[model samples]
Target chain A: MKRRAFLLSAGGAAAGMVLLPQLARAEAGRIDWYTGSDQNILDFWTNIVQPKFEAANPGITLNLVDAGDNAGLQAIGDRAVAAMASSADPQADIFESFDPRLPKGAIEAGLYVNIKEAGLSNYSKINPLAFDGDYSVPYRGSQVLLAYDTTKLDPANAPKTFADLIAWIKANPGQFIYNRPDKGGSGGNFVRRAIYEVNGNDTSKFTVDNYSAEAADAALKPAWDLLMDLAPSLFDGGAYTAGNTPSLQLLSQSAVTMIPAWSDQALQAISTGVLPETTGLVQLSDLGLPGGFSRSVILANGVNKDAALKLADFLLTEEIQSAVLTELGGFPGVAWDYVSPELRDKYKDVIPTTIPVFPGGDWEKAINDGWYRNVAPNVVRE
Target chain B: MIIWPILSAIGRTLWLPGADGVSRFSLETYVFFFSDQYSINNLMVTLWTTGVCALLLLPICLPIALYLRFAKGRLAAYVQGLAIFPMFVPSIILSYAIIRVLGPNGTVDLLFNSVGLPKIRSPYLTPWGPVIGLVWDNIPLTVLILLSGLGAVSDQSVEAARDVGARRWAVLWHIILPRITNSILVAISFTVLGIFSAFTLPYVLGPAAPEMMGPFMQRTFRDLNDPTNAITQAVISFAFCIVFGLFYVRSVAKNRKT
Candidate 1:
């Protein structure tokens, strides 16, 4: 009799505590987001972005998938193109950190949503400089900066101009190295800036659509000469690091005093204690180093385009943008005014207010190849 | 099935899309690879690393295998264990350990400094870096193949040579060395093949430019973002590997006849 009373009271309590059962909503809206990496990128989405978006719109389910690596991401682009041509389901709704230039002219073909007119509530707050085109919705960004060891060189003495950098490199042989231009963005941007330096500060010729073999040859020859002149001063007597990480690794080991590194990665390494506390970062005053924004594109013909759009909008919202800045050491895609005041105050000194972007596409590829052929011609041992 | 990928890779190298968007036969990739000094440098580096590694493996592993074959004690077992130890360690881990030990201002340099020795010129990011790493990696397999070949020599053959006034050195040279010729061939064949196509150790330890074929192909694909060029590099690497592969096949066929 006592057990029955206890069971009845517990059942009553459970009944009282439970909310009304909602209708089954597996089919309501399952938006599959294909992010390229299963590392920090996936973690950012699954942990920070998903919970709030789903909580706000209960019926919309956020599905995370790892497309993984460049090849995998390219395949996803191809799939969208194929599905668009056949008028079938695109299968994927969202792609995070997707290269918009993939599939050649997918942007012009309307394969991706036009975010400017998509009516994202935070559209007004978007950083115009960071935004690529209507196809790309950049929510987070990072810049390449001159990362140097403070213990070895004082901030006052660190190079401020491209000319100073060259002079400093010459003065300190075997203390500076950049990765090979083709290997990583940090290295690529370093070469890009050097190209800018030698071409009489003409950033205009280097554009998203502006590239010609004749023009490149004329402009790049001087850059190559300048870089080749500086090569003998680099770490390991002109040896370049393989990538962004290796450059940093050499710095961490104190093998090199300076390198070009991504702001986010450098910050992350410093905070995570992978790099020493004495490692310092500074941007060049003249023709500042280029930075990039991570963009997410929604397929125009996605099965759950509306939900995907909503999620894209949510990524630009103040809370999420702040999270990107705090959590990933990434710059907010939204403008400084749109970011929380406390964060603005915290990062104003370290974060460049106007992050300059280098031209990508054909120009980047040409520069990388030309760099290999011209500048580092003597990389082979005798 | 294996041949299909190789054929496709070769096909990709020869067949390319023109600026006119018409598919046609082309030798542009090959022309570029052979004529371009940078590409040729990369090829030469690959060849150098393979040749050096294959050459080094015989000298490094033969002595340990010869000792293990005749010695009857726990010390031989320990020597065998030490020689084969690298086979268990992953290449990536080995590369890092090598970097730590041989990199600039690393353990060796620090120890040398403490003892008032001149600084060691680190080989961490030079052509010789991959050579050191590859030679260490191939030791186990080379020794094992050598030991098996030494097994055929028969102690009586060695003892008979010794009885005929042959010293230990003479017995080793005349009896042991002659008997293991096939094994040495087989070991060299395997070593050449493995070193020819190796990627990880070379990619990590080797220099940025003049990279090995494995890293060269990958850098062309992923970094240069030229899949076609990468495939061309692969086809060329395959051509070199095939030459070494033929030696293995011929030796095996010869052994079968015997």
Candidate 2:
């Protein structure tokens, strides 16, 4: 009798261990969210947002999976493409789309659901520019700006135009640094702005869907000339740092006084003590820098389509947008008037009058290739 | 299962439809990769770094492995422990530690300044940086392999050589080195493979241009969005690796035959 009782108890315990999780899962449906943001954003979603969201909407759990950033974005896109190719459900219900062109491609491919039909309450309040057709909802935005150390530079003397910036770089040799164009978007933004300036501030020439090699060569000649001219004045005489973080590191260490950086990342770095508090940002008046919105897309064939739409709506709420601004230093997805007054006041000086989106795929590739081939060799010291 | 995916990748590389939506087998991708001088430069840089890494590591690891094999003391134990400790540390963390120690205003600069020496710029932005990091990160594995070979060496053979009036250097050159030829080949094979395919070290330490094959391929695939060219680059890297791998196989087979 004792042996039978022990065996029965052991079997019962094992059965409970296996079945309990399934029961809990059934009670609390899971929604997988894939993000390509940094650790702080991940923690905010897991530690703060997940618990509250779960509490308010019982029987639903938020599964946050950090995909990665930059390269991580590509990985998520590749997985989505593979799933779509096989006629299978994507791994995640909601995915953070970092590249603007990716969402456009996915939408065209019919891989994303039309969120406008989901009847999200906050969708109407979002900036219309943030919407890509009816498929994606913008989560955050960041602009590229010229960031400099106040200790090494005078704010009054900050360059207000592209010409002034180039002159400053020429005058202050080894005091400016920008990452390689292919490495990060910040350096690419600087190059694009120069291209815009060289075309007599005409933005329409390079924004087309089809790449014209002849037009590109004609427009990019002056920009390449400017870069080659500034080459001798760059940090280490001509060699650029590898990425955005390295350029910022050079700024913090006073090796270089100014660099083009994403406004949000630069501010976040300052607040987190990665950069000194004396750092300041300025938007050039004559030429606009490139910036874009980060959006969340719902997979058309995701397991939890309704839940993903609900979560995306929650991300656009005023309270959540406020947290995005304060906690992550990201611009709100809503209009400036919709954000809190204090947030506007805090970022007023650094904000540009216009934030242009990156050019379409064909033009972008042409510019990147052209810069590497025609300009990089002439500019790089080694 | 693994073969399926490998075959699928190869098929994609050979015959996958491109942006134009045309499916055909062609060497167009390979031609594109080689057409650019920059791409050719990247290939050369990758080979050069791999060669430099192996050349530097052989002298450094062999002496340490020999010492660890012959020495008997707490000092030898400590040396052994120190040599193996880096293997446990992640490559990312090790790269950062190296940057801090060797970067401008870092410990190395501070030491130089304290001695009234001129401040030296950090080498982290140059090719030397990745070469140094790769050599350091790979030393432990190389030493471990050499030590294993040293263990297989016969003490009696060395004693016999000494009894026959052979010098110490002669014994080492003829007996010890010959016995460990296969092990050295294995170590060289691993070193070449690791350095050729290294990403984080070169990405963080090396210059923006002339990137090693690993990071260059990643950029080409993802950033450039040219999967065809990326796969071709991978195929090239794989071909180089197979050459070394074949030598390794032959060495092992010969040792078995002997």
Candidate 3:
């Protein structure tokens, strides 16, 4: 009996040793990640993605650091951070910057790694025009849409066009509010959309391929004039202007009624009870598209290039994309037709089917010359 | 090595490229600042705000310092302690507290609302707030310096003035003013330098486009990452500060010689 007990104990010790390495692999080594996500994203990645990635790919741990926003992401470029994530286009890697003029810099600086070489260049999955020459990927796309508080103004009274919106502001003094273009992406997108509607000969004429100095100004003139005219009806009766977040704050506090907001921003606010549940989002009938789109890029020389590409690819997967669309307020980059039925039912109505017109490469140069000089001075700097 | 970088930045700031490798030195930045009219307006506002603070500080500080020197009571010690108390508080905490009082929705706004008036917008955000906060923080040192000067007044001089049939007003004017003129100059010099290098109070309180050297320097370094412009601005500010410092030192030396 004593010999049998000893043999059983020895057998158990050998079994423990056999299982230990496998268990350790399941918990993986840490892979540092940087993202310009709010606390919600921080929580989502930690609770959901981190554990799942760790479990599926043994010895792979994702340690995420919150960079908060674009400015914070830019700060990482100024630092020795492992990776960066932003909503701006590919000026830096694992981030976002919209300046189309910067693609050359990324290529020249070797700050970009072609995902095509990584066996993840599934370009056919995304909209043809949205695909870059192996530089950036559309992470989550949304357009600037008109949002209104139902309690203050009924749908019947809502403005349908930029012209209608301007007229309404005149009719009802001190009603419309938006942040300055420099302050927030959604706010800047809204202003730029106004420029597009007022300037472009047709929607297709607004593409990067078709951009010219004359087209920019001609499209921008009407919007510029309208904003200058409506400057009086804005906050402080045009005496002061709030930036994007503050403008949203004004909308939330019932200080203003009609404003432009991102689709996800509107949904995020409504879901969290930060905004009224009765809020409505609509695309302009005349413009067809919403406002703008965001892109994501990979750093060429990051600490974990392979892992970052894997994560980027995983994020683009139909399942993960669907989850992002349905669970998160973000719109999926994959075409609506390719979306799963579960995701389709959940987010089809909430996300706009219409693609927004983004400013081609000339957007930055035009803004620097036109709006900064002409528009900024008229409004109070606040 | 540091000097080379600073000089390079200054050279780049001053010289603009043309067709060839050679460039022309032009004060385009300074010209731009002046052309906007903000530079003069901001300077005037900064001075006026600092002036008001100095005026208010003068009477409150003088009496407390004098009492600390002449009086023998516990109250004198307490007064001296209280006069320099602002120096002990962290500058950020001090600035934040002022914001609470002067902000649009601050306590002062409540007072305005009670009278059916609009909320008071802060002068700080306009360029005045920082000057006011800076002077409040600076008054302690000013008082301490003045008090030390007053203490150095000899007992013999007072007796001599009394024996020579000098009236209180006459003695204060002729003897006290001349004797402490150097201290007064020192305080003024310190105040000028203090306001010149100031970043935080103005930063928290000033408007979007602050005209002072502080905000300009900050923007160049942080947002622009154009260290050349930042170094150039610093060098210019330093030049002006050095002139004032030299004048102050000369005045103090001249007074001692007399």
Candidate 4:
């Protein structure tokens, strides 16, 4: 597959020279893009957004590469592809905002052209939380949520807090399960929520500016102890864990009563009829849903700066955002009010009004602290 | 291409897990490697699998090699080809076949339970699954070596030993075995290194917790951004390769030294 792409790239580059003069006049040129979308989302991009963007720009090509799963994109980081279509900051003209973890130092080092200075069309419409007059803007905000089977769990008897959830699990053994947080993003987010509830949500101490090493450990102690106590009643005696896919599989099988689900998964389930349409959504009272502002970034060093900028402007447009958020499962980076009514209706109730941002200056510390690492495994042992 | 990558991987592996230095001057990775139980546990699993695989392969290969070596004509040629056939199938296919044959609901399990015998727990979840696969993989090479070496032993010498009033067991053990000693050493040394660096069999077939060093390397490089640890694992894996590589080289070179 890689070899085929290379051959096509070579062929396209040759064709590009012959088309360059014609492209400048009446203008049909290709704009290469890289995105971490699946086939369904890719179809939406190709069949829907690409045609619209190309029709508007006329004679412009939009070459997109699906960057694959989260881990694959993370492994390459933003720098490795900064020169390719996948690069956030290609060496030539384009810049994109797909990576939220764009290192502040790398951007400050002038690695990416600040989109704020680039004068994109309708920059004002972007949410301030996502577009901070900086190197990138957020395209979506996803959260981890708790869901229950409508048939087995009564809405009136639903657990409201971490303590309530645990007590319910104890009362009904083998009735609840969540994917392992270390293996799945939703599980990790759920674990973080548990830590916050136990620590009274004072995770600010773990930030670089105020990180007291002892305080971090102390905060996680109770959460760890609780997890150790709850391990046995977990699904498969806490031995078998599923990622989001398997967690959802278990839910669909009715093998589990409760599980931690990504907001998008729950929304997808409800939309597709895999989950009951009447399912209720709630945050733990003590710990609000763990949320993070998803940021997309442009590479400081990219190959085609002009084409990349054009692609970025195109993606940031309402047309693409509406089509993407509606078809793919997630909230858009634009404000809630700005979304099309059709898209809003599909997700408004499902998407949380508020999301927790990983407090600045190093979230890794907060995530890796003893509370999460030392105590999380006890979930299977009970 | 695979050989170059494996060799380059060996150089890359020399650097320990925690060492982040650009220049060559640190043993911090070694210290970190030894401090962790995960590393030690995986290494022990590799050794145990190697031992079990060697034990299972030796007896089966020896007699078959002996039959092919001394047996005359068409039968000998057919036996030689049939004996070497196991090496033709890739190790992964062999393992999958074993899983189907020995899995919980597989033929072996059904057979045992039908006879009122205790249900045989599968080795798939244990190091033994990989051990079995590796043993099956090495059988052909071991068989060929034993067969050819037995063929080279003079028929006249065996007949003379038997005629001198020596018992059948005594004549066979004393005269026949000594002639094939080099071939046995060569097979053992070569098979040891091959199994030591094996990754796929264990990765596809082994249990989760007590994973071999190979799977642990995959998780470190791709899942965890801890390249230092990945490099450390690659290094230890090469250390196994080198130790076994040197032994094989020495055994081969012993012929020149003689």
Give the residue spans of candidate 3 off by over 4 A. A1-48, A63-137, A141-160, A168-180, A183-187, A200-225, A237-310, A313-372, A378-382, B1-10, B24-107, B110-118, B121-258
Q: What digit string (tens of lDDT, one per residue) describes model 2 on residues A101-136?
A: 563477677677777887998888887656556778
Worst lDDT window (10 residues) for model 3 chain A?
Answer: A82-91
Candidate 1 docking quality: incorrect, acceptable, medium or high: acceptable
Candidates' lDDT values, in order? 0.84, 0.81, 0.63, 0.65
Number of the candidate with higher TM-score, 3 or 4 = 3
Question: What's chain A's TM-score in each predicted model?
Answer: 0.83, 0.79, 0.67, 0.73
- Model 1 clash pairs are none
What TM-score does each of the candidates earn? 0.85, 0.78, 0.63, 0.61
Runs in model 4 deviating more than 4 A are A1-44, A56-94, A98-135, A146-160, A168-184, A203-216, A219-223, A240-319, A335-349, A359-382, B1-32, B35-38, B45-211, B217-258
Evaluation by lDDT, superior candidate among 2 and 3: 2
Instruction: List, residue by residue over A146-241, the lDDT tens digit for candidate 1.
Output: 899999999899898889999999999999989888778898888888888887777776777778888888988898888888888888787876
| Decoy 4 TM-score against native | 0.61
Ranking by TM-score: 1, 2, 3, 4
DockQ, all models: 0.32, 0.34, 0.06, 0.07
Off by over 4 Å in 2: A1-39, A45-139, A208-210, A295-322, A333-345, A378-382, B1-35, B159-168
Of 1 and 2, the candidate ahead on TM-score is 1
Categorize the docking of model 4. Answer: incorrect
lDDT by residue for model 4 (A257-336), tens: 88888776677777788777656655566555676545556554544456666766777678777765656566677777
For model 1 chain B, give the 10-residue run with minimal summed lDDT.
B215-224
Global CA lDDT computed for model 1: 0.84
